[model samples]
Target: MSRMILRALLCLPVLVAALAAAPSPARADALHVGLVIPQSGQFRLLGDHVREAFQVWDADNPGAFGDIVEGDDGCTPESGVDAAAAMIEAGVDIVVGFLCTESLAAALPILSNEKIPVMTLTVRADIIGEEAARLGWSFFRLAPRAGSEAEIAADAIYRFWADKPFALIEDGAISGRELVEAVRTRLEERSLKPNFVDNYRPGQATQPSLVRRLKAAGVSRVFVGGDRSDLAVIAAEAEHQGVALSFMGGDALHAPEGELPLPDGTMAVLASGVVPGPEAEAARQAFAAHDMIAEGLRIPAYAAAEIIGAAANRSDYGQTNLVDLLTGTPFSTALGPVTFDATGERQEPGFVLAILEDGKFRRLSVDDASRLTGESQ
Candidate 1:
């Protein structure tokens, strides 16, 4: 564990991170990490996953942190403020957890007063990013920025349907409209105009008219800036019409499927959350020992602990030095190398391309995308 901690901090080659290091007389006087996550609200389950992962990692690393002060984010502004106050009272050096954006937003100013740096596993709103840049808050995220989904959606469309004629469509919801507009703007900048661009009245049982229009446009592929339910309807309607139209959608594609599940070939570009692979072997073994699967927010939360251990080991480590080290240097973790950008967003948060096959979104690769989207006519 000590050697692994050292390798995680690739930038600080000369320093050996004290995570899981040999016990010493002063070992109890180590850094205290404050954990603030939703404990009594709709998002409680999310917070639980994060906390469980943190505990597993802490156990694996043993003497990595002096103490862990736990608090509830409450998943609301008032509760968030209370949680932050608890952290300050506990005199913690750094903070982790904070899955709720509202909770984190309300808590940041209080933490900023004490110059405490924060490490979030899953708060990825653009407003949080704007506030960080505007207020100069010391925040580091293991998640992508909000608009990353639209950018990734556009890139995936180009890769899969650049040669094949494809249409861009959206439901009238704000999220759907914005995603469609962003994708259209990006494609136009690259001189790739869609065969059709339109909005459909959402929440209908069927979309025969929309599917007819898609067939009329001679498009074999379509990108939907809408929810999974709406996409499911369109895909079903197209199949009913024998149009053979393939569909790609944004994060909303993962929503719970009602009676109509999305067609098998439907693809979605979802935000990069915790996609633990072979790099997470050690973490996986640790999780398995506890009878837990290394998945979901657990992976990233464990990665957060790794970042804290490695970053805290610097000779001149302090709250103020966190942002500099996190943004400028890369740290290896269960989720590959975690490097942040100026806005505290993960720089290389690659989107997950999932295909709705066998009633689930399976991770997809480029070769699989080609086969699923019917390979451009």
Candidate 2:
């Protein structure tokens, strides 16, 4: 009995050694990403596109994401807070998507406290810039800032209408007024100025008097602060009165559902436009497969997913270290090479200028806007 006891004790150490040598059950390699998007309300369309883009990418690449938690922000600041809290409860390592500016602003501090990195797929340029500056490095934006949009818009106006006498008009909305001011400031920097500047009441049926005012001012071109619909009345009155005028607008005119039927030669500045490249091929194919239109938030959402997936694959994606892993790496995404500038914004072209031709928006070359619009090159 004593000999048997000794042999058993000796074999117990050998068993322990064997157990230690064998690999433990493989840890879950999948990463969890939270999607905070509007599932209802006016912004639901944007959230749906963002969700589809992320799902398509995940499905195409098997085992990339372990679990996806969706929190509907409903495009409201209060809902944003709730959504962020829900994501934290779900044990999400990172968050992607917050289409509304207010929603994103409300969710920032909550997500930041949990150290969960957020990749914004929407364009609230100024909000992102301000938050990033104030809070250090928790936010990563894939879209252009408002100021960036304004700067590009200003450049677009100068490129196309520098030699022509143009008028600047706004609908009195703060955004519209700011955009006009941006363009006007850029023009003045070049020793040029608008022939006329004024604010017109929006939603008016006929602006015969405003048209006559512009005609008398001898302005051949007009830069509107709002969308095509904002200037539709003025444009009709101008055409009826035999006033030959061209129109220009900001990003609102690049509406995915199509802009109001502005006349030919009308142009709008977009923060970004799809340019074919190797990186964009997969998403283009994925979108085409489902007959899903890839516009606005779709491309940006895909890019955001690619960024998080890339970061996860490159490093250990455990919860407390995700942000540290994403800081300095240059992520190659469908939107092309993406690297956050010092302000945590993507470094790329400021904007794209598209002209309405035959009732469609066409990509306009930057060489000169005048030649494209029947003005002297």
Q: Which candidate is the best by TM-score?
A: 1
**Which residue pairs in candidate 2 collide?**
125-145
Regions of candidate 2 where Cα sits further than 4 Å from its true position: 1-29, 123-125, 256-260, 273-281, 315-321, 366-370, 373-376
TM-score for each prediction? 0.85, 0.82
Q: Write the per-residue lDDT of candidate 2 for residues 91-133, one digit (tens) a residue.
A: 9988888877888888888888887777787656575677666
Indicate the residue-level lDDT of 209 in model 1. 91
Top lDDT hit: 1
- Give the distance in Å from residue 207's predicted Cα in candidate 2 to where it truly belongs: 1.7
Location of the lowest summed lDDT over 10 successive residues in candidate 2: 270-279
Give candidate 2's error at residue 281 in angstroms: 4.3
Measured with C-alpha atoms, the lDDT of residue 5 in candidate 2 is 96
Ten consecutive residues with minimal summed lDDT in candidate 1?
20-29
Each prediction's Cα lDDT score? Answer: 0.79, 0.77
Tens-place lDDT digits, model 1, residues 1-377: 58787676774643445543645533223578898987776877778778888789878777768888899887788987898899999999888878878888988888978878777777767788788879988777777666787788888887778898899999988888988999999988889899999899999999989888999999988999888888888888987899988789988776677888888867888754433456778888888999998766777788788887776665555534565666767888877787888867777754677777788776686679667457654
